[model samples]
Target: MMGEFRDFVARGNVLDLAVGVIIGAAFGKIVTSLTEDLIMPVIGFVTGGVNFTNKFVLLGAVPESYTGSQTDYAALKAAGVPMLGYGAFVTAVISFVLMAFVIFQIVRAANKMAPAKPAEAPAPAGPSEVDLLTEIRDALKKA
Candidate 1:
């Protein structure tokens, strides 16, 4: 069992998969940050500052007794408010679309850069065995 386990862990495919998973997770975080921190802000600014992350409605209002004066989605949620988190959903959808588009572009560029297969020439025709034998017989008769 130990030997089998060691072999499985040391295999090239398994190690490559582990590395891919780690890199994918890190890339996901970077894309998420890029969308949230950079893209969304620019989009919002261009669209009259319509902030996407804060665009949610609360089902329960904070009681007047709650001294904290906060109005963001998290604050509303922390106040036991039922909410529709549409902003986060939209952000996620946009991020996914962007990621897919970037991946497609990368793959397309890679395919374009790959070497093309060489064109093959047609094979030359060869004489039949009978034809060769006839020629040989004629030469032998002449000799």
Candidate 2:
């Protein structure tokens, strides 16, 4: 069982999959930072300085012990307030689209860089079964 496990781990596809998962995690973080820090800020600036992350619909009353501002979405949530965080959902959607676009571009560039496969040569033709049978029939008639 240990030997089989070792063999499975040692397989090239398993190793490649592990590497891909690690790289994908790191790439996701990069995309998240790109979306949250850079793109969202620019978008906010363009839309009259609207912070989408802090936008939410409050469903519950603020707790008596809560000290944070009433308008603070993060604070309200931290204080156990029930709210629909649609802004965060929008941000996540934008991030996903950006990540998909970036990955598509990467794949496109990789495809362009890859060497083209040569066309396969066609197989040589031989006499058909019917032609061979006809020849056999002629020989049998002569004999």
Candidate 3:
């Protein structure tokens, strides 16, 4: 049973999957950072510094004890106010699209750099063993 377990662990598929999962987690962090730190800020600047993450419409009553800005999404949420988070949804959508595009471009570049499979070996040109044997048999019959 231990040998079986070792064999399973040593299989290429399992190792590949583990490596892929680790890389995927790291890539996800990179995409998230790109979206939140770099892309979103540039997009906000292009749209006149509109902060999408903070944009929300409150549907519930504001708590009387709440001292924070009513328009602030985090504050309102913390105060137990129900709000529609369209801006957050939009931001998530944009991030997803950006990550997808980046991954696609990466895969495209990888494919371009990968070496192609070599062509199949061609058959030999001389007469086959069967043909030679038949010729020898005919010569023997003639002799």
TM-score of each: 0.70, 0.83, 0.71
The TM-score obtained by model 2 is 0.83
- Kindly report which residue pairs in candidate 1 clash with one another: none
- Per lDDT, the best of the predicted structures is 2
Please, what are the lDDT tens digits per residue for candidate 1 over residues 37-134?
Answer: 99999999999999998888666666776665455776776777677879989999999998888779988999999998788878888998999999
What tens-digit string does per-residue lDDT give for candidate 2 at 14-124? 999999999999999999999999999999999999999998998887788999998888888888999999889989999999989999999999999999999998988
Q: Model 2: runs farther than 4 Å from truth?
A: 60-67, 132-143
In terms of TM-score, how similar is model 1 to the real structure?
A: 0.70
Winner on TM-score (1 vs 2)? 2
After TM-score superposition, the amount by which residue 77's alpha carbon in candidate 2 deviates from its true location, in angstroms, is 2.1
Span of 10 residues, lowest total lDDT, candidate 2: 58-67
Query: Candidate 3, residues 5-99: lDDT per residue as tens digits?
Result: 99999999999999989998898888888888888888899999998889888787887889998778877887788889888888788878987
The lDDT for every candidate, in the order shown, is 0.86, 0.93, 0.88
Pairwise TM-score winner, candidates 1 and 3:
3
Order the candidates by lDDT, highest first.
Answer: 2, 3, 1
